[model samples]
Target: MTEPGGGGRTGWVAPLCWSAVALEGFDLVVLGVVLPSLLDEPAWGLTPATASLVSTAGLLGVMVGALSAGPLADLLGRRRAMLATVVSFSVLTLLCAVATGPWTFGALRFLAGLGLGGVLPVALAMVNEYGRSGRGGSATTALMTGYHVGAVATSLLGILLIPVWGWRAMFVAGALPALVLVPLLARYLPDSRPQPPPATGAARSRNPVAQLVRDGYLRSSVAFWVASFMGLLLVYGLNTWLPEIMRAAGYGLGAALAQLLVLNIGAIAGLLVAGRVADRTGVRAATPAWFAGGALFLALLAVPLPGAGIYLSVLLAGVFVFSAQVLVYAHVSQHYPDHARASALGAASGIGRLGAISGPLLGGGLLSAGLAYPWGFFAFAAVAALGAVAVLAVPRAVPARAR
Candidate 1:
């Protein structure tokens, strides 16, 4: 039988942790889906450059949040840290609906990004703690499925609500879950075990970057960061530009959007399959292979093929593209000690945010240059290949219990 605080509780822990990530996913993609609506508003007067700036600002804020939250969670406890982040982002997102101009909107997005950034690491830590030994990969995969689920929900919202209620309504809708989950988290969530109670009762020093560079960990930390950078670049870039890329490949709008749906469906399936596969094999064994497959499939993304062939390739690419990066996060949890778990996750995510920032901008540049489809697929393929190498070289840093 499972103890009260044992891994069995991961069922609840994983879902609760996902609530925050779900909110992030919802907020992240909803902006893209709603951009057309924003452009139609004369009051906003948003140029493409101005709109891009707003996105950049939000991404910068997310990187800051991801980098900073590690230590804070280390000091404050994961549950409380996550709750604070959720509340902060939720309120700020609501405030976004009321913003009057481009500047205000961009500023609000940046502020919201802070909350968005921090919540992910904290939630990740919670799931890792409750996860069974040797099951860290599966645990993280399960939690991150929430991200794709959130994205799926936003797409549905765009179809159902955007036509009637409009874009601002999307932000308002994003706020509801935070309000609902905040109280539930406060009531039911358990604290992560403290990190050795901060030596001699002195104030805690919780810098993830600094700690990661310390004795015996520097090489692994750098490897993971490199892997994260490439993995997320492929993820964000593909999601941002897939429709445009597909269109350039001669698919109609209906087909392009259908590809998006297909991609995410494959993503959901990949997450479930990856968790099970990684649990049976090893995260170390599975991640590099997945990234390699992602690279191969992405390379074929823009090649003209028969309808059935295109569908199968896109589905396969989605499976590997989304899940390969997730496996990276899973590996981080398994490799790190409990005390540094959140920090490790935070650092990987924080660094990965750089790629997130670059992905869309690069895709847009390619589109403007009229090299849209082939360039995007080719670039993503290269990044995926790099990810394969970076992850393949990861030393057997798995923790004793995790192994």
Candidate 2:
């Protein structure tokens, strides 16, 4: 009997790594949920603008962390890198509960972001290695489903606990995985790294990241980075401003908020649908199709249809926009050999964070200029279409050798 991750290994590693991804998701949602209370307290001095800065601060740290993860994962094995990152973020998240002011809170979140940003690529690499028969799409999509699950769980916790225990307790909840997951991962997860053939010896031990763009991989590598940029830009932009965008279009506040919930529900449903399709159709084909669908659904949002029609559009947009990006991750995992896999993912994810930062900023800018609604939605549709074009630029065949 053979295993997908490696021979003679139990199926425990993927779940352990996935739990780390979920922890980051939980920690992320906690910040979003807690910010309102922080603003109301006044002691924190969290103006909406300052709160946005705090958000960007964490994202910047995540960008740095993500950029570094690939190199570090290449230097240290994936399991070790994953463990260190999970511990780093979880411990820092606990520190967030004790912060004295907005600056301190923002600083802690920034530091925690380093750990949060670093883990996903490593985890995705592990899951991709664990699965077999080039099922990168199904495996990665299945793993990312844990992210939304973690996000929804934190949203529920915010509602239940923040009112009683307050926001600090919520951060504390985000920290619990350190105690449970770190040990579980150490015990259960097998190390994943590429095996350098004996022929190369000392010569082959060059930078893994440099291998991504040399020879046959340059075109695909650039295309993947650009596609990831567009995908995440759409994701963060819409998640941050969707409610506000809808309200600007004249929908009631309650309906706008309800649409967010519907969107996330659609995201969860889309992940399952996409995983199966990507597994069969191949990520190269499926990812672009999803993004194309996202563009259409998003463009339809500008029309202000009746209640059911609007809900359907929101749901469909949610389905395509988020999963389309994850499909790219699937493609990357399948594209690179095992050794360079984490580095490739980390680079792409790091670049995508730029888009994440831009999305909210772009929407906020448009809102300030009174151009948010049709223009914002139109811009989002255009970006999704651009992502599809980027995907199409990926080379049909990339050399299998690690350069």
Candidate 3:
């Protein structure tokens, strides 16, 4: 890693990147939060079927955006790519407030997701590139904490504002990140990726995507994608279904929602702890353990535990579920060369979007088809177990300095 100039510039990277991702989290959860309000308005005529389609549309856009971003961020500067995406997302988000119908709202969300999807890989790449030596894993994990924080904030806003000011106003509030965060990123976010002198001729011009699978990296690259897929599947599934599953398991609606809150609280705590541990013990070592622990906690949720036991299990579940996925990102950033990091992370996440899209659908199907509360946990556990095996399968390679 290139030596950073001072603490001030280094400090801003995390917070600024975190804030950008937080906006993604906010936009992500706000749609779910406001869906009920949209449904309530007969004028909008949004049935569950149509709403599901709308949600999938946005995710489809995310997958497309994520896959496309790697090349741009690699060819362009990370800061410039991130800036363009953040601006587009913020503007589109503001436009969401003015959407009059399901089609229009869904179209806006799909467009905004283009921006949202691009930001994460670039942000992860930025954090990884700027991080100290072996701490790339830790720094990337630390940056992801912003995503969950944004989710929590959106939840609170939905509870407070969606009831009073209505759904459109809540979407309007999503635009504040642009006004507040864009300036900080524009001013301080480094245009430089940890430089180590320039390459010569064709080496400098090779595409990031093609670079990822070259030089005996194909196996590890594939493994990271598989691991990410399973991890994200678990994450999106639980986040979408946890409340309803808890409600089915006999908790009241309020308590079920509160348990979801506890889960995110645990996720935040896990990020703090996991990043440090991964840095200390290597992401390759820590990731499997995390996935195994996540699977175990999920299985624990399947048993008919007491209320406190349930809450504790949920908290522990959060601890492993989300960060395990992030460690995959960490693993990518750590394993690949600087030139390949953004593309590697982007491809992994972009492919993993399939799982993200499937997760909610899987949960909804389980919930609708019966055996939701009990069986859903088991399914998540199974997926997490697979994630463990996938990560363990990655062939260790010497880090390259192609950049």
lDDT of each: 0.83, 0.85, 0.84
lDDT of 2 by residue, 279-375 (tens): 9988889999999999999999988797599999999999999999999999888887666788889989999999999998899999989999899
TM-score of 1: 0.92
Q: Pick by TM-score: which candidate is best?
A: 2
Off by over 4 Å in 3: 1-8, 193-205, 398-403
In angstroms, the error of model 1 at 365 is 2.7
Better of 2 and 3 by lDDT: 2
Candidate 2's C-alpha runs over 4 A off are 1-8, 197-205, 399-403
User: TM-score of the candidate numbered 2?
Assistant: 0.95
Q: Is candidate 2 or 3 superior in TM-score?
A: 2
Candidate 3, residues 230-277, lDDT tens digits: the string is 988988888889999988888899998888888888888888889999
For candidate 2, the 10 contiguous residues with the lowest summed lDDT are: 1-10
Model 1 lDDT, full chain set: 0.83
Error of 3 at 7 (Å): 15
Off by over 4 Å in 1: 1-11, 197-209, 398-403
- TM-score of every prediction relative to native: 0.92, 0.95, 0.92
